[model samples]
Target: MWTTTPHIAALSVPTTDPSNTKCYTTKHLITGNRTSTQSEQQLPTYSNASQRSILLATARVIIFNPDNGLQATLNALIDQGSEATIVSEHVVQSLHLTRTSIAGVGQGLSLADPQYYRPKRVDLIIGVDLMAQIILPGIKVGAPNEPIAQNTQLGWILSGRTQPPREATHVVCHQAVLDTESLLKQFCEVESVPERRLNTAEDVWCETFFQQTHKRQPTGRYMVRLPLKTIFDPSMTLGKSHQIALNRYLQLERRLTKTPEAWQRYSDGIKEYFKLNQLAPATTSERQSTTVSDSQHHCSSCVLPHHAVYKEESLSTKLRIVFDASANTSNGRSLNDILCVGPTLQNDMSAVILNWRQYRYAFTADIQRMYRCIDVHPEDSEYQRI
Candidate 1:
């Protein structure tokens, strides 16, 4: 086997042509004291400490060279901006070099600097001029062994210039949470209605809500139930059936006198009349012979004899007469000024005379306090109060 030996030599300065000078130039020396070699050795060019630091710290820098031209400068800027140094076709052509696979032709001008040397593992590249234009001042850069420079550049480009740092807050209140809690407490503290009333109220509220929400008016009539006991009574004046008929007649009279149009429609197809019938009263011998069954049936019966005195006119004729009487009583008078007539002979005579002109000739005597003239017990006059 052949033996290998190292060569060593003194450092020497590199030579430069004066005609190629474009910017400031510097001389560098290279030394190989560790190894011995017969061939000439290459030396590293010396750079200014301040200048090197400036270049390293600069996020963006512009360079102009006579020999390299603007295209080369643009390429160099793009290479500095990008993670990987790129060589363009135009750059190679300007430098009088042949096209190589290592270089790629990219569309649109980029900020990558072609002069900046980058490792093969780098995935992205950009230019210093582009970075200076895009990146905000708030971002941190140049950390040792940090891979976030690319991320920082991206953030700066998207977010624009960063703002100055804000002072820290000493105290803070959870206003949103406090407000939410207050509202919830108020809602929980509200009293709830009983289930039955709640359901009714909810139905009414929903009906109202629908009406208001849809801008529709409510429609339908309200009905009220009247007690028959409040109108008719068991008294000596008339039979129960007669009292019932009279009560109905008075009710119709009130309705027609108060609201003629509404009453007219209500009574349009109805009929009214009086019928007479006869029955025998229970005698003492009959009562003594009456069994418990007969007593059970007759206990609530009246003692008066039921006799057929007169068969009144047809229901249609009675209604017509009643309507005519109401009209006559209401003539030349407003609804508010009209007086109510009771079921008395004097009132009935007046109504009959007012209704029939032929009856005006009968008994032309004027009596004061005609209603007061009739003696009525305090309890019996309750029905007439209305």
Candidate 2:
């Protein structure tokens, strides 16, 4: 059953660090707390009294502590005016801390300060820092007195002034104070002489993988394996894609038929691929075994769908075959999805330009079929099967 009320859904995304990301998982149940936790704070020990009342903007949200895989539902204050986001100390204390290390932060930094202790009633305050990330673009206002609906990554939140409470006598005013000194210190840390750039765990693994797997062939061409993530193996999830590749090939043929010049270039390119030993026919046994049905029995070879790309501006080799590694298999994931994209090894463009400026003379040379120069490792070639 469904209701006509406007709503937004929080989409679940796969992540290596689920605790850190705002992703939803069904492993744990998260329910909102409707009962409010009320508290009163007086600046000068209740010297002033008020007779009017105002509505406070609060939304029920599930707060997750990725550090300990603990999640709790609480009513959060939606303060768009505040610059910093803060959670109650009690909320942090309530969540179990099994691990000492935070996801991406180094061990030395301490975020806790006794000076900024918030009252228990204010369970969570979603200030500008987090609001910028979670708040989605759209606002729905119904009638003149209804609560305004605001969209966020978590879901739709209902806020704004509703019907005033008849029993309300005191006007509750809340003030948010930001620590400028701490913020300035953080800003100075970012702006000061920079420390050595630290590579993430994934980046280190990618570098190690390249060093271990990449090799130079007798012909001076480099053969490298696709840097695939270990957690999500394509062989396990990849579905029957032979038909998909075949359909894409047929579509390419139809598209090429419209332009005979492009068709001839494509045909010549295929012939060149065979002539240069870049492409080869599968053996008889392989052809017999590698089929749509055979895929279910074992880890089948991936069939990469390819098409012609025409770059008219290029002085040499205007046409090329572009393999679509990102083409979706029967399963939602693609080859690109599982691959850990290795870091760029080349120098920056700015550095190259600076070097060029220092040199008395400079000339440019182009490598013939530069894109095809790198050879895929033999074991990894199945992933690039066309």
Candidate 3:
């Protein structure tokens, strides 16, 4: 038999025998504008095919108010089938909920995997939209009887079939239907034309900086200075990063020990950097020099730290060395914070594709080591130090 929970706004499937008198909860939920045609018809009925229980994916999460920093812990159900994450009304009543402008940027309250929504009794179903943003590429598999563990930004989630309770009798049949209306709406939004906007003051400054400082070498390669703000001196603001880099390197070494192939690739990539003159060893004077005016703490010129980002699907490079330009310094400001982000230089993908069809022959290619090809000016090389 099929029944609806008015409060949760989800369809629940029950056993065929009424005497069983037991029901199991599931993460799959459908919520959106239901068409009149769909609403008018009687809800379709479903029955358990067999008396077998299925395991549902679930995790414990903590929710917090971004404004006051108030925290609450709750149980959450991870549902890849659902379109949107949902919270019970009870959660809103308990905490001061406010709408945030940042969406898909991981700044919104619901986007945080570590802490999400809902109460103890009610489960917060985390849908595909938010799940895709916070998920990291890490997974662990164990023996047949053991639950598989999947690593996420929130933490490790253990999920798989477990032994059912002795008293449990009713079996569960799961079904997650895609909302046609929501899919159609998303399709329309993707096809819609984006509005053009003017560049901000910072963008204008970045443009001016590029035009004034950029140079071309005899080999036809372009060199540019880092777009640093005039207000703060980087040498003074940035703290010593030797210890931080050492700790990160040690952790990476431990992880790489398990995968010799990955370790070899990482070593080869670093060697290429030095061979191309993109990286070099610090001079004796450069290493010893640590002078800052009006600063109690010793600040280093080379304060950048980096980590390895593994992408098995990448065709060219599997392991990428991503420098942490956004790492906070002693004053809580970062290299990214002091730099001006320029306006996007490329046209929209829609415009590019539209023009592509006009050509007699269409060819697709991507630049190899695109960023590494460009050189930083000698004066600004210190800021680019890793």
Show the lowest summed lDDT stretch of 10 residues, model 3. Answer: 3-12
Winner on lDDT between 2 and 3 is 2
lDDT of 3 by residue, 1-386 (tens): 11111001101112475333221111111111110343221211111235332334556778888987777776666767777777655566677676433334211122122332111244366889889776888888876644567787777865554333356589999999999999999999889766556899877877887899878889888777666663344442555544454455657777987999888887786667657656643332223535556763444343455556789998777997655555565656555555555777767788778888899998888867656666666545554444
Q: lDDT of model 3 at residue 274?
A: 55
Task: List lDDT for all candidates, in order.
Answer: 0.27, 0.55, 0.54
Provide the lDDT at 345 for model 2.
57
TM-score ranking, best first = 3, 2, 1
Per-model TM-score, in order, reads: 0.13, 0.45, 0.47
True lDDT of residue 162, candidate 2:
48
RMSD of 3: 30.6
Clashes of each: 31, 0, 1
List model 2 lDDT by residue over 180-252, tens digit each.
9999999998656444456788778888987998788897877776666634453544554555666777788
**Model 1 lDDT per residue over 238-354, tens place:** 111212223444455565667665455334422111011011111222123222332231111111111111113643322322111111110122111111111122234444555
The regions of model 2 sitting more than 4 angstroms off are 1-197, 230-236, 283-300
Error of 1 at 250 (Å): 70
